[model samples]
Target: MKTALENVHDWNFEINYNTVTAVVEFSIHFVSTEQYPLLEYLLTNGTKSLLLLPDDWKLYEEHLSDNEYRYYLGGCIRAFDIDTLIEILSSNFPCIYSRLKKNSIDALLHHDQQAIHGPARLIGEPDRYRFLNCILNAKKQLKSS
Candidate 1:
């Protein structure tokens, strides 16, 4: 049986910049079941550590009701700032981060969105390839132990 991470064919980082509020909203989308444990592992135990900060925890609490927060914690869906998004990518996927940092976050995200594969409507294959390679390498390391 394929692992949850293995089942993931593609994923994306979505950015929504509010010109009026000047807040850069971010989220992640991928092809995995909501019940996948890897999602929780990525949010809680991954190198990026999304919920580690008090402010982020408070923001989740304030913005989401109990059920919504549960889903967020489960990694079904999430909403956060650009900085958090940057931190997550930089820590977890440095190769992709290196490519993305050449331009402003808004411009980079827009460019990446335009680069998505038309048939799959997924993030650019180059980025996804690097991401999956990193993930598979990590999984290999864990298994070899």
Candidate 2:
């Protein structure tokens, strides 16, 4: 399935256990067949998060309600392991971390940052739970320690 974010590039997730900070850094080919110039973004786990759109794109609120936009945008964040994310959110937002499991992770980050409706496509699901077990097991080890 070709998602609104079909041309996803390298995406890296970094977790700072000590600082309780998680950063999702990634790049995407917003424009088809583009080279050298890619749309890069850095999303941190916090209130004043960011949704840096490409220079040619416009930002609006309606985009927030778009499924394709949400599917692509939310999928980027949702692409992370759900369980580990729950654990991470649990530590930071103890009261509402449960909602993370029940809801879209992207909603937590870029819900109301933009107002314009943009195009988004459907993304395929290929091993969405990439590091779920490893992270969860690591957390288990840490708790045991």
Candidate 3:
């Protein structure tokens, strides 16, 4: 079996929030950094590559507070060098989640679907759901699940 880090490498993902079905479906493929500009930029920015969801790009711009957004960007740039997996909009970081006490992975999924008017993609699934759950809540996502 592949190590967690190894598994994360060969991934390209898509997310569909079925407005009609009121459901979500997400899938991943073995895509290289060539398939994503952010990944490419991370590699070129003196880091290997930072794995994050597509919707995160939007959240990076829409963080509930200016401090949160600034801190998030600073942290991500540093973490990217270490190959950390980030689900920014997912409010899935344990530290961020614990502070906010908004815990629920399912809710994070809802925000993802609603991002940009009904569908957003993660750079890839998080290494852990608990972490993502925290980030979503910290980001002020209102999804109940």
Candidate 4:
């Protein structure tokens, strides 16, 4: 079976600014933590100490731009990464679901509604309901399950 890290490597976040680079590199760092195994991973693995080169450091710089730095800071983003699966096993990390809802709500209010809603409708019939439900009931289901 593919590890959670490998699984997250395939996930991408399309932010409006320079977050693409930070997100990719952050994904790489999380992928490196797969060795620690489910619950123990975040606590035992040295992910917090992962080093970035100078170029990679520049991508996360606060002084570079306004919008870029804010979104890329990873405060509580919903973007898919190794943590999405890890969050299932560990409560120490922030949940992606909460962040996703914040993103979706913010998108609905500020961004083009169609841009957010239209593609969601395009989800195939069989899985569409489940997909939307997952978004709607993320926290409740997480607790129940």
Cα lDDT tens digits, model 3, 51-144, are: 3222343322223342322111211323222223233323322111001112445445444432212212233335335434543343342244
Off by over 4 Å in 4: 1-63, 66-107, 117-145
CA lDDT, every model vs. true structure: 0.33, 0.29, 0.28, 0.26
Residues 22-129, candidate 2, lDDT per residue (tens digit)?
Answer: 322222322222121222332223442233332334211122222322112111233244343544333332211001111344543543333112233212222223
Candidates 2 and 4 compared by TM-score, better number: 2
Model 3 poorest ten-residue lDDT run = 93-102
Per-residue lDDT of model 4, residues 1-145, tens digit only? 1222222232222112123333222221222212211111121121231111213332232222332221122222233432432333232221121111223454456544333321111113333343334433444443454
Candidate with best TM-score: 1
Pairing residues by index, what is the TM-score of model 1?
0.28
TM-score of each: 0.28, 0.26, 0.20, 0.18
Candidate with better lDDT, 1 vs 3? 1
- Candidate rank order under lDDT: 1, 2, 3, 4
Off by over 4 Å in 1: 1-4, 37-49, 52-145
> Candidate 2 versus the native: TM-score?
0.26
**Best of the candidates, lDDT:** 1
Q: After TM-score superposition, what is the CA distance of residue 45 in candidate 1 from its true location, in Å?
A: 14
Task: Name the runs in model 3 displaced over 4 angstroms.
Answer: 1-10, 31-88, 92-145
lDDT of 3 at 101: 11
lDDT of 3 at 52: 28
